[model samples]
Target: MALMTTDTRYTKVAIALHWAIAALILCNLALGFFMEGFEQPLRGFVIQTHISSGITVLLLSIVRIVWRLTHRPPPFAPGTRGWEKGLAHLVHFLLYVAMVLMPLSGWALISANPPPPPPGQIEAAPAPVPGGAAPAAAAPKARRGGPTKLWWVIPWPKIGPIQRMGTTPQGIAEQKLLHDTLVERHMQIAWIIIALLVLHVGGALKHQFVDGQAEFARMGIGRGRRAPR
Candidate 1:
């Protein structure tokens, strides 16, 4: 195979998207684990941020995948070990798959749960008029049935009919089961992604320092080139 030249580097757009997605994923993972520690309003706020960030990841991942399909990345440098190259390819593929699935599972889980009631202003009861009776209390507005909004701003579409299932007693039990199942799956996949990241980062460090390959530059960050591995 022809060795990719040292001059080859990812486009600036690809590099920007790559780092941005990485940052978002790390933040989302942290938020997922810690959001429950907060009280209601703050917890709600963090959850909103987490969901928004996850949606952003999904959107960026799609664009990244399209860009990658259309523009080939530079090949492994000269004398790269077969095992290292193979492992790198496998990790990269899995990361892409996780990026797509993580947010989707999250959205599904959110849809399974009911949307919170909108914040309402408190009103004083009207004073009794000179003669007769008190006014009837106003009925609450119906909850909008759909996917949870991103950051409580952009509306996201629901995945399954899970929201509807929550209405009945029997359905509530089923919804709880489904919601828990999806949460387990999402957390499991998250750990897989984290494990893959450790391997990926370790490999880069090995290539950069131990092998003196400057391999990290392929993603457009580190200095390019060194003695051949």
Candidate 2:
């Protein structure tokens, strides 16, 4: 039997990381869904924000994993079934995998096909010649992959191998194929994360409301009830 104590709650750092990552993931999901509807500079800004948020989630997830490995989580509320515990563990594991993979896949996607210049970087077409004929428009610059700024501030490098795929015909074709595959995979992983999140939240609610367990409290919501002895 386990002794009842407040010590059963997760560590403060774990709780902070959990909420931070959750918030970022939700925001990024929204951005991904609606980014296309935006026009021009706004669209570019939204996409960059999405990437920055994803990278932030990835970094925080790594920290959270390390914290989890070192610190023991509170035991399940008394009377919790073995199957419930197993399912919870499985969902958590998948969430972690999805969290890591989603950002990495996004990085790879961008690397394979570098994004166009942001609105600020694009040069305006020269005014038409005052007298007779319009000046010929300058040719658009070819996109050579480069570092992205996190939140338009910190520099985040592209995946070298993926970004360095040459400009040759063959290399371009391979890069395009890889980009398409990664785009599909990224969406697939997102759906998986959504499913896992549903399960996780539903399970917690079931335990807290139906079973009268201090589920949220264990994750630092409210005061935790004593663990069953």
Candidate 3:
């Protein structure tokens, strides 16, 4: 009987992107939760570095995803456990979801409740008013493709409680309620994503240190060379 082998190690591109993004997300998560929400003496330097690194990770992730569409990754070993394969897929999918959602949520959360404005500058609406449609006779504008549209979601304004008008008390309350609800939900999702990420890191460590496997190297520096079937 022959022992089975496989080209299971992740590709160099995938490994590099995976580790890079993972490190960025982990740092950002800590900065977001520990410093800001935790009420620590807000260090401007930490947050600036976090934001800059996160943007780099996101850009690289996009390129990696595009590369993946073009170049297929190696397959796992035949003897590999099913649960692990499933978990691996789940981890990756969750990562992508969290990566995209966290930033968007951050943006939305910031828009809803931003830092104090410069003295004199008036805080305005929750979101921007949508541009009015052109005359009926005018041709519709060309639709831009991909996640670009997702980011450009109807421009919302950045306003605060100061802008609330006494005349529209009911409307104001409703909008406030909606904004609070969204902000709360976004935060909850972020926490859940963070928990999952902790688990993910733990699992990788377990595979690397406890099991004495080469998983981390395969993902981090792309060292492992999976054998041809």
Top candidate on TM-score is 2
Q: Write the per-residue lDDT of candidate 1 for residues 6-112, one digit (tens) a residue.
A: 24566667788899999999999999999879998898689879989999999999999988887778777787899989999999999999999999898778777
What TM-score do all the candidates reach, one by one? 0.78, 0.82, 0.59
Task: Judge candidate 3 at residue 102 and give its lDDT.
Answer: 67
lDDT by residue for model 2 (60-81), tens? 9998898788777878878999
Q: In angstroms, give how far residue 62 of model 2 lies from its true place.
A: 0.7
**How many clashes show up in model 3?**
5
Backbone collision count in every prediction?
0, 0, 5
Give the per-residue Cα lDDT of candidate 2 at 110: 79
Worst lDDT run of 10 residues, candidate 3, spans: 138-147
Ranking by TM-score: 2, 1, 3
- Candidate 2 Cα misplacement greater than 4 A, ranges: 1-6, 114-146, 226-229
Error of 3 at 182 (Å): 4.1
Task: Tell me the spans in candidate 3 whose CA falls farther than 4 Å from its real position.
Answer: 1-8, 37-50, 113-179, 209-213, 221-223, 226-229
How close to the true structure is residue 134 of candidate 1, measured as C-alpha lDDT? 36
- The list of candidate 1 runs beyond 4 A from truth reads 1-7, 114-147, 167-169, 225-229
